[model samples]
Target: MRKANSYLDLVLNPFNLFRTKRILNINPTVIPQRKEPESINLYVYDYDAENIHEERLKNVKDCFTYKHSNRVTWINIDGLRRTDVEVICNHYGIHPLVQEDILSIGQRPKVDEIEGVMFCLLNMLYFNEKESAVEVEQISIVLGEQFVLSFQEDASRDVFNPLRDKIQFRQNKIRQSGTDYLFYTLIDLIVDSYFVVMERLSDKIETLEEDIVRNPNKRTLARINQLRKEMIVLKRNIAPVRDMVNGILRSESNLLEERTGKYFKDIYDHIVQANDLAENYRDMMMNLHDLYLSNVNLKMNEVMKVMAIVTCLLAPATVIGGLFGMNFDVIPYAHHRWGFYIACSLMVLIPLVMLYIFRRRGWF
Candidate 1:
């Protein structure tokens, strides 16, 4: 066997201990979707001016009995299942495209007018305190001659309890109005919810502003980036909703009653306000990001100024030592008995005089 001849060859050999080899797991594991079906909840609220009937239906077919009822019906499906949405939408004459939009996730807010129904889909936003983040759920509403069908992606919570109480405790205006008012009322509740979320976000921004002004650090920068992302998402989701509401107001569908036009107009104004607020918040985030950078740089410049002053004040001492320590036969102050003491005095006195000059001139 041949051996390495010198230290260079030995160090460069393949068998040396200095080299390292790594085997990476580039093939990530795939997580499969569950075959079991998630549960779906169906609720029916049928009401008129004199009386109201509310029930939670166990079977999907039971919901159809209200389809032909003369009273105004509100069928709220709390969870999305493709088969369930297709069946109920088919019964209500809702088109297949509308059904797909109802089941699809992350769809943009839009309005659609079909043969017998006027449909709109939008996002419902919620602030999660524990996660310090914004959460979103998709909601689709179908307005027909006798019924208003609402589909929600989440079943845990919604912002419709007030409407429920109003219905249960004899809110005469909604009870006396037609299905179009119920449709309008449902969309109105969604728009009103934006104000609540905006309030919470505003409070957060105010607090973050104080934090940025008082003391800025890495955590402050992280929070700034996070809030900037949230504002972008908030703005993106809200901007489309204004157009969707405007489309509804201009819709030619016969399902929209002429009397409800005023109510939809009010909602359009509110959406515009919400969009404006989102834009304002996005601008504030940009300003805060710039402020954070400026503060960090200002502090860094302070530290560098101090270091430069110290280096300048010590310059005389360094020069004197270098001159006397040179290995020359005729160097200044090299052979005198008192040369060391005299050089030390010069070193100390020169720095003191230079410091006075710097103070007078404000260089430091």
Candidate 2:
């Protein structure tokens, strides 16, 4: 039967040529996780010009008092799973769509203005040297008049510790300013972290450039491809961040004060610089790939040239041996006393003559 033949083909086809014949569902409600397992940690800190209060709570509900306090409150929820994002969303009046975006770890860098909150989504990128790959984590920030809430996918690591130190030491204007300025400081810190990632990438590119020149091999090619992929991931995350900062500048929301506009613009400029660096690195990666290919081809051509010279040198001897190997009774040197010596001499002489000609032509 035709159906039996079809089933047999499906079972016997080693290449799985018909694997794609199955219909694909265009709509699916799967929540994709891009990283390994994570644990949730909540940090709540409230501060003013002369005083500071910090607390690390195991539950999000425990921070309700600080969230509603008169002072500037910074509630950072690191890791997405343990605490209910919906409860935090309800506490802050965050939109349903924004809550979904927060839950979805793979959301791109963006900015959204809801009823009374300013929402931002961005990626924190770092180089994992042990794995030789770039790791990305999403950071979500919700800005309000009295509170600033941040969400991240990983609780084990972050780039905000310096900002925290600055705030605790009362070393900067962060304590003297309002929540909007605090928001600005946080954004500035995140943008500054991009430079660190870019620096690592630059170092990688430089090292790879040297490796390509010194000893290009399969491992070198693999590293080049890996770097290329990491660069792409950086560019993908950073390009939208630039646009998001620009969007914040153009937003008419009162949450961002007019005075903070300049700060956002400064962040914008930094993102642009980072983007340009990523682009330059991409171009360098492409050039390295091309150089690796050309090097391989040149080496192959050298090997082929040597082989061709060897074959040419042996051709004369091969012809002479074949001619004398025949069983003809009347060959040219068949009866000469020194026929064997003369034959050997010609064989040696012919190759020497060929070698001289090849040398003159600079074949080697």
Local distance difference test scores for all models: 0.82, 0.83
Off by over 4 Å in 1: 1-37, 330-342
TM-score of 1: 0.84
- Give the alpha carbon lDDT tens digit for every residue of 1-364 in model 1: 3443545644454232221111111121333221323878899999898888999987677898898889999999888777788888888888887887787656779998877788899989898885456777789999999999999878898888888888876656888799888988888898899888888889888999899888888878767776776776688678999999999889877877788899999999999999999999999989998988998898889899989888988899999999988888898768889999999999999989988998999876
Q: What lDDT would candidate 1 get against the real structure?
A: 0.82
C-alpha RMSD in Å of predicted model 2 compared with the true structure: 7.4
- Writing each residue's lDDT as its tens digit, candidate 2 over 1-364 gives 9889866864575333332221122122467544534456889989988889999988778888786678999999887762368887888788898888787755678999988999999989888886556788788999998999998888889999988888887757898888889888888888888889889988888898898887788878767867777777788788999989999999999887798889899999999999998899899999999999998888889899999988988888898889998999999987889988998898899989988988899877
Clash count, candidate 2: 0
